[model samples]
Target chain A: MIHAIRARIKQGHRTTRYPDEPMTLPERFRGYPRLDAGACQDGCTKCAEACPFGAISCKPSLSLDMGKCLFCTNCIEACPKGAITFTNDGRLAANTRDGLVVGPDTERVLARALDNKMLSLFGRSMKFREVSAGGCNACEADTNVLSTIGWDLGRFGISFVASPRHADGLWVTGPVSGNMLEALRLTYEAIPAPKLVVACGACAINGGPYIGSPDVCDGVDWTLPVDLYIPGCPPHPLTILDGLLRLLGRIPEK
Target chain B: MTSTMRTFRNGSALPLGDVPVLETESFLKAILDATVHGWRVSSYFGLPRGGGLRIYCLMSSDSRGSLGMAAADVAGNAFPSIAEFCPQIQMFEREVAEQFGVVFEDSPWPKPVRFERRLTDRTAAGCRTGRPSDVGVMEYYQVKGHEVHEVAVGPVHAGIIEPGHFRFQCYGEQVLHLEISLGYQHRGVERLVLGGPHPASLHQMETVAGDTTIGHGLAYAMVIEALSGTMAPARAHALRGVALELERLANHTGDLGAIAGDVGYLPTASFCGRIRGDFLNMTAELCGSRFGRGMVVPGGVGFDCGPELAETLLKKSAAARTDLANAVELLWETPSVMARLENTGPLTAEAARELGLVGPAARACGVNMDVRRDHTFGIYSMAQIPVATASTGDVHARTLVRWLEAEKSLYFIDEQLRHLPGGACMGKSNGLAGEHIAVALTEGWRGEVCHVAVTDDAGRFARYKVVDPSFHNWPGLAMALRGQQISDFPLCNKSFNLSYCGFDL
Candidate 1:
C-alpha cells in the first residue's frame, strides 16, 4: 500500500485540462476538413478521385461528409489545386444527419445541444451503453479511453453503464455488421424510453471504409434514430467528450 | 520430406504457375510430411478456378526461415480433412468449407466459421453450401453431468469491448469446457478485396483490426510491393519499423493495464491506462492519429520522421518507458495481483504448440516463435529484436512476456529514431506483374500477420488471404480456460485479448 501510494505520487497528475483550459493537440492531428472550392482548377476532380470513400463531392462546389471521411488526407494530397486541407478543429459533431455534410461556404458544423426537454432531463447526468456492431476496436478503444484517469468523463456526470437498463442512451460504434444487427437493435430496445442514440466514429455514421460492403448495414442511422453523430475514422476521445458535452448543453455551441 | 516441398523467401513474389499444384493425395501427403518435419501451416484458403475450387496451403519452415506454397484442386467439393492429423489446420479447414463450400471430410466440428450471409452468392462460381443464419446460434459442445450449469455471455458483452459469445459448461465454480463462438463482427473483408487492389483496399486492410493498423497495413504494402517489384526506401523501412514498435508499445501497455484492471488492481490499472495513452500520443506525434492509421501506405510509409521529430519521439519514449516501468512493476510486487495472475488459466506448452498459437500467447508457453526473428522481413531482417518467452503458460506468463516485449520494442524504437535513414519515405509502386502469388508476413503486436495475394493474368488480385494471429490464438484462449474457475474468465480472456473482428475477417 505504501509502495502503491509512492508510485501514485511519483506519477503526479496526468489528466488533460480540456473545456476548462484549451488542450493543445499535435499539429499533425487531423480533425475537420477545410474545403476551398474557388481554388479548384477548372475540370479538376482530383480530390473526389483520390477519396477512397466518396466522401468528397466536387461536381457541385466542394462538399465533404464528415460522417464518410476517414480524415486520411488522401483528398488533400491528391488535390493539385490545394483546395482541401484538414484543420485541427476537432469539434465536428451534429444533431441531424444532413448537418454533418460541410458545404464550400460553411465554416464548420458544431454539435448542437439537445432541445429543452432532453437538456432538462439528461443535462446533469447521461449514462450510455456502448455497442460495437463491427468496429475494428479502434473506436471502442477511444470511447473507453474517456473513462480513463486522463479524461475522467465522470466529472461531467457522463458514464458508460454496464447494462442498457442503466443507460439514458446507446453509444453505437462500428459499421453495424449483418450478424451484429439483431443484437445492436436489441441493445437499443433494452434502453429505457426517451433514450438518445449517439453514433460514434465514421463506421457508425457512414460505414467508414466498409461503406458499400454488403455485409454491413452502412451505419447506425439505418437501424436506430441517432440523436447525435460524432465523426472520425475513430473519433478522438476528446472529440467524443466534446460531442457528449455539447449534446448535454454542458459546452457552449459555436 | 524437404525434397518435395517448394520454398520461397518471406517477401518473394512467385509466378502462380510455378507453385506446385500437385494431386490431392500428394498435396495432403506433402503437407503432413512437412508438418511432421517441423513446419506450420501459415495460410490455407480456396480460390475459385474454372467452376471449381483450388485449395492453396502456405507453410512456414521456421528452422529454414523459408515459406512453402502448394495447392490441390478439390474434386467435387469434397476433400479429405488433414485436421485430425494436424490439429492446427482445423480452423482453416472449417473456414475453407464455409467460404468456398468445400467439404472437409471427417473433420471434427465441421461448422460455419463465420455464419456469413451471401456465402452462396459469393461462392456461386465455386462450390456453395451452408445458408446464412443468425450469428452465434450453433451446436456447442455441452457438458453433461450433475450440477454442470451452462452460462452464456455476450455477443453483446458488459464491457466496452467487441462482441463475441462465450459459453461455459461448469461443474459448480470450475469450468469443464469453454467454447468461444464469434463472427459477430464479420464484415466480409476477404470478399471485398477480390479482383483488384481497389482504392479502398489499403483502408480495408488498416481497419481489418483497427488496433493492428500498422501490422496489417505493413503486410498489405509488402504484398503490393512484392507484386509490383518495388522496394520501399530505406527511410520508409526505418519509419515502418518505428510505427510497428510504437503500436506494440501502445497495445502491450494497454493490455498490461487491462490485465491489472481485470484483477481489480487499481493503482497499476489507472496509471498504466494513462501511460498507454502516452505511447499512443507519441504515435499521434508521429503521424497525427493516435492509432497510427494513415501512417503506413503501399510502397512506403505515409509520413516521414525528421531529426527534430525523432528527438521529440526519443525523449517522449524515454519518459513513457520510465512511467510504464513504474506502473507495471506494481503488478509484480503486489501479492494480491500475482495470486490472481500466476497459475490462473494455464495452457501447457504441448497444447499451445498443437493449437498453433502465435504472438505473446504462444511465447508465454515457451514456444519461442516470433515472425520478426523466424521469418525475417523489412527492418527486422537487418536489425533483430530478441524474442521474449516464459515457461509458465499462465496468465502471469502472458503478462510478463508482454512487459518484456514492450521493453524490447522501446529499445528498438529508440534505436531506429536515433539512426533514422535519410531519404524519401515512399517509392513508386508500379502495376503488378501478371500471374504471380506473393506472401507478406509481419509480426503484429498480437502475433504473426500473414497476407497472401495471387494475381490473375491481368495483374489483378485473384485471391487475397489474411491470417490474423487471433485466428490461431482464439483456440488457445479456449484451451487456457479448461479446468479453470469461471470467475477467472475475464482475466484469462484479457491475457490473450485476441481480436474478434480480425478473426472474423
Candidate 2:
C-alpha cells in the first residue's frame, strides 16, 4: 500500500486540458491540411500524382479528402509550389462526409454540433460501443487511450460501454471487413433507434489505405449512417475527442 | 527430387530459380529432416503457378542463423500433409489449404485462417454480390457430457479489442479445451497486395496490423528493399531501430498495465497505460504519427531523428523508464498481484515449443527465438540487444519477461539515440528484380512478423504472404486456457495480446 501510494503521487494529474485549450501535438505531427489554390501553379499535379489513396484531386482546382488521406506527407513532399501543407492543428473531424473534402480555401474541417433535440439526448452523457469491423487496432488503441488518466474522457461524461444495448451510439473503426460486416450490422441493430455512429479513422471514413480491398467495405458509411467522421490513419486521441465533443455540442461551435 | 534447399539470410532476396524446386516427396522429407534438426517453419504458402499450384516453404534455423527455402509443384490435391507429423507446421499447412482450396489429407484442423475469400475463381470477389456471410460459424470441438458446458465469446467482444471468436469447453469453472476462430478483421491484404502495389503499398503495409505499425511496416519495407536491391543508409537503420524499440516500449508497457488491471491492481494499470502513451508520443516526436506509421518507408525512414529530437527522446525515454519501474515494481512487491499472476493460465515450455509460439510468450516459456537476436536485421546486426527469457510459462513469467524486455528496449533506444549516425536517412530503392522472391522477418513487440514477396515477370508483387506473430501465438493462447479457471481468461488473454488484424490479414 505504501508503494501504491508513492506510485500514485508520482503519477500526479495527467489529464490534459484539451478543447478548453488547444492540444499540443508534435511539430512533425501532420494533421489538418491547409490548401492554397493561389499558391498552385498551372498544370501542377505533383500532389495528386503523389497521393497513394487518391486523397488529392488536381484537375481544375485542388481538393483534398481528409477521410481518404493517410497524412503520409507525400503530397506536401511532392508539391513544388507549396500549395498543400499540413498544419500542427490536430482537429480534423467533420460531421458530414462531404465536409471532409477540403478545397484550396478551406481551413479546419471541424465537426458541426448536433441539433438541439439530439444534443438533449446525448450532450450531457454518451456511452459508445466501440466496434472494430476490420480495424488495425491502432484506432481501437487510441480510443482506449482516452479512458486512461492522461485523457480522462469520462470527465466530459463520455465513455465506452460494454454492450451495444447500453450504448447511445457506436464508435466504429476500420474499413468494415466482410466477416465483421454481418456482426457490425447485428451490433448496430441491437442499439436502440435514433442512435448515433462515429466513424473514428480514415479506414472507417473511406477505408484509409484499404479502400478497394474486396474483403472490406469502402468505409463505415457503406453499411451504416455515420453521424461524425474522424479522419486519420488512426486519428490522434485528441482529434477523436474533438470529434466526439463537437458532435455532442459539448465543444461550442466557433 | 532435389535434396538441396536454398539458404538465405533474413531480408535477403534470391532468384526464383536459385530456390531448389524439389518433388513433393523430397519437399516433405526436407521439411521433416530439417525440423528434426531443430529447424522451424517460418513461412509456408501455396501460390497459383502456371496452371498448377506451387507450395513454398521457408524454414528458420536459429542455430545456423539462416532460412532454408524450397518449393514443390503439386499437380492437384496430390500433396501429402506434414502437419500431422510436425505440429509447428500445422497452422501454415491449414492456411495453405484454406487459401488455395486444397485438402490436407491429415491436417489436425483445416479450418479457415482469416475467412478471407479463397484465391479460387469461384469465391474470388466474395463481396461482388454485396453480401458477406457471417464468419466463425464453423463447428467447434465439443466436450460432450453432463456438467460440461460450452461458452462462445466474440467476433464482437465486451471490450474495445479487435474481433475474434473464442470457444471454451468448460467443466464447471475449469476450462477443458479452448478453440479460437478468427477472421472477422480480415481486410484481404494478401489479395490486395498482388499485381502492382504501387504508391499505396507502404500505407497498406503500415496498417497490416495497425498497433504493430513499426513491425509490419519495417518487415514490408525490408521485403521491398531486398527485392529491389536497395540498402538504407546507416542513419536510417539506427533511426528505424529507435522507432521499433519505442513501439515495443509502448506496447509492452500497455500490456503490463492491462494485465495488472485485469487482476484488479489499479495502481500499475493506471500508471502504465499513461506511460505507454508517453512512449507512443516519443515515437510521434520521431515521426508524425504516434504509431510510427510514416516513419518507415521502403528505402529508408520517411522521417529522421535530428540531434535536438534525439536529445528530447533520450530524456523522455529516461523519464518513462523511471516511471515504469515505479509503477510495475508494485506488482512484484504486492502478494495478491503475484499470486494471481503466477501459475495462473500456465503453459508448459513443451507446449509452447510444440505450438511454435514466438515473442515474449515463447521467451516466457524459455524458448529463446527472437528475430532481433537470432535472425538479426536492421541496426540489430550492429548492436545486439540481449534476448530476455524466463523459465516459467505462466502469466507471471509473461509479465516479467515484458518488464525485462521493456527495460532492454529503453536501454537500446538510449544507446541508439546517443550514437545516432549523422547522414542521409532516405534513399532510392532500385526497381525490383523480375523473377525474384524476397523474405523479411522482424520481431514485433508481439512476436515475429514475416513478409514474403514474390515478383512477377514485370517485377510487380504476384504473391505477398504475411505471417503476423498472432498466427503463431493464438494457438498458444488456446493451449494456455486448458485447466485454468474461466474467470482468469481475461488475464491470460491479456498476457498474450495477439493482433487480430495482423492474423486476419
Candidate 3:
C-alpha cells in the first residue's frame, strides 16, 4: 500500500481551494435564489405558486421570506423572464430566527451584524448527523461524495456521525414527509441540548417541488424548529462546504 | 440484442382451473398455482387502496420463480390465510393485515400489524385523542425461543452508513434469527415524484439509491420512452451504456474495498479506496458529476461527452484497469485476506435461485440471469460483453466475479467511446398516453427495477409503482446470512449493499 499512499500524495490535494480562491462550482449547481426586480412582473405569481412551502409573499411587492424559502428552482424555472436565478454565493447566517428574512433590505446594518455574530459563534471542525425527510437523493449523493477519497472531508475535520446523540449539529435534507415526521422529530430530539439544525436543501427549508404531497408534509419547518437555512435544490459541494465553515466559525463573517 | 423476453399473449392459464374473478379466496389460490407447480404459499398481504381492500399472496415453488399479487375486489372478512401452505409467507401476510386493516380468516396470529400492544382498554385510547401523531402500523410475528436474547442495533449506526435496525437472536454470536427493522429513512421519493411535477422535474431519481442510479434511471426512462414509443439517439444510447458501465466499476471497486475492510485487510482497503476514488474522479470528468448525476434524462442524456473528456476518460479507464489488476493480484496473493474471504458466506446455487436472487449476488451463485445479455437494452447488445458468473457461490467467488466485471466494465467503456457516434442525444415526444403498461426486467448493477406507469386522459399521472431491485434482493441477503457467524454479517451485507430507502419507498 506504499504505492497507494504515494499515489494519493502525488495527486496533491484533490480538494478545491475554497474560502481563499473563488469556488469553481459545477454547472446547474443550486444555491441561494436571487430575484431580479427589474424583470419581475406586477402580480405575476408563478414563483410564489411554484414554491412547495409558502416562502414567497405576492402582496404589494414581491417579498421573499428567507426563513421559509425552500431554495428549490421551481420559482426560478417558473419565472417568465428568467428573473429568478439561484446564486452560488451561500453566505447567509443570522442570530435570531427572524433575522433571516430576505426581502427589501430594512435595518440592513443590524441584520448583517447579527448574521456575522452568528457565523462567528459556531467554531471550526464540525460534526453532523444528516437527516433526510423526503428528498430525491441528490443532496445525499453530493454529501456522500464529499467524504469519499477524492473529496476526503475528513482532512477538514468534518465527519458525518451515525448517531444524532453524539452530534453537535443536524444536517437535514429533503422535504419533510408525513411518514418520516416522527423519526425526524426523534432524531432531532436525540441530539444534545446545545445543537443546531442546518436545513441543507430547498426541499428541507421550503418544500421544493413536493410541497402539496398528500403522502408527505410540505416543509420540514412545518414539523420542527430550524436554525440555519442553506438554500439550494441540491446545493453544490463548495456551497455546502462554505455554509458548513460559516457555521463552524471558520470564515470571517461577511 | 438477444432478447430473453418470450411473451405469450393467448396462452392458457397454468393452474388448470379458473375460479370466478369475484371469488377473491379461490382467485388468490388460482393465481398462486399459476406461478409455481407445487405452489408453496409463502406470504400474503391485505392492501387498502381506492376505498377498498386488495388481498396479496406471495408463494414459492421449487427453486425458481415465486409469485406475489395485488388482488382486486376482496372484502376484508372473507380472504383465507395461506400460512399452512408455506411458513415463509408469514411476514408479508402480517404486513398487509396491519397496514390496510385486512382481517384474515383463521390467521395463526391475529394482531394489529403496526401497533405493538392492543389498545382496547380506555386509558390507552384516551391518550391518543385530539393529538396529531405520526405512528405507523406495527405488526410482527411473535416467535418465542428458549432464552432468545434480543439485540437492537440502530436506525443510526456507528459508521457513516444509512439508518437501519438489526434485531439479532443469538446464543453468544451464533445467530438464530435476524429481524431487520427499516423505514427509518423513508423519504417518500416515489410519492413525491408521482404527484408533484413532471417526470423530468426529478433528476435525482437516478441517485435515489446512489449506486443503482444509472440502472434505475435507465429502466425508468426506458419504460417512459417505451410507453411513448420514442427511442433516444444512437449517441445518447452509447453514452448511457458508458455511464452504466462506469457505475458498475465504481460500485464494484468500493464493494471490494469494504469487503477487505470487513475481513481486516487494511492494505487492501486503502488500495481499493484509493483506486475507487480515482474511478469516481474519472466519472466526474466524464459526466461533470462524480456519482454520474444529471447525465440521464427521460428522453436521453442531459449532457454529452466531448473529445477532450473522452480522451481523459480513455486514459483514466486504462489506469483504473491497471489499478484493479494490481489490487486483485494483491487480494488473491495475500494469505490472510483469502483465509477470511474463502468459504465465509456460501449460498448454494439452489438456495440462491429459490430466494429469487438477482445481479452479481445471483451470478456468483451460478445463475446466469443478466439483464444486459438476456434482456438487452441500450448499447449492451451491440457491444457483446459476456455475462460473468461463478459456480462456487462463496465470498471468494463473488469477489472474483466483481473484479472481473470491473475489468469488463472498463472494456465496455473503452469500446463505447471508440464507437462514439455523432447525433442528437434526446428525442422529442408528447409523453406517454393514458394506458397501463408493465415495464419489467433487470438493470446491470441492481437486479430488476419494475416501473408501472398509468396516466389519465389529460396526461396526469394516475398510479405509478416503482419496485426497486433492493425490494427483491433484501430477502436474498437475509437468506445468505442465515448460517454465517455474526462477524460475517457485514461482509455478506456489503456483498449486496442493499438500499434501505429504495426498498422502503
Q: Specify the highest-DockQ model's number.
A: 2
Q: Which parts of model 1 are misplaced by more than 4 Å?
A: B118-133
Model 3 stretches astray by more than 4 angstroms = A1-22, A27-125, A132-138, A162-165, A176-179, A222-225, B1-147, B187-211, B267-294, B315-329, B440-444, B456-460
lDDT (Cα, tens digit) per residue for candidate 2, span B1-505: 1247888899999888888888888889998888878788888998788878999999898878889899999877756888888888888887887788778886777777766667654344545256656587777899999999999888889989999899999999999999999888888788777886678888888888888999999999999899888989999999999999999999999999999999999999999989999999998998889999889998899888778988898899889999999999999999999999999888887888777888999999998889998899999999999899999899999999999999998889899999998889987778889889999999999998999999988999889989999999999999999999999999999999998888888
Q: Scored by CA lDDT, what does every candidate get? A: 0.89, 0.88, 0.61
| Candidate 2 TM-score, true structure as reference | 0.98
Q: Report the Cα lDDT for candidate 3.
A: 0.61
Point out the higher-scoring one by lDDT: 1 or 3: 1
> Could you give candidate 2's per-residue lDDT for residues A1-254 as a string of tens digits?
98799889987888888978879998899988888889888888888999988999986688998989998889888988888888898988888899999897765557888999988989999998999999999999999999999999889998999999999999899988887888888999999878999999999898889887778787888668889999998899999988888888888787
Q: Whose lDDT is higher: candidate 2's or candidate 3's?
A: 2
Kindly indicate the candidate among 1 and 2 with the higher DockQ.
Answer: 2
lDDT string for model 3 (B108-140, tens) is 755432232111111212111223433334443
* Tens-place lDDT digits, model 1, residues A113-152: 8899988999998999999999999999999999999999
Tell me how far candidate 1 lies from the true structure as C-alpha RMSD in angstroms. 2.2
Per-residue lDDT of B40 in model 3: 33
In model 3, what lDDT does residue B300 have? 87
Candidate 2 Cα errors over 4 Å, as ranges: A107-109, B1-3, B120-129
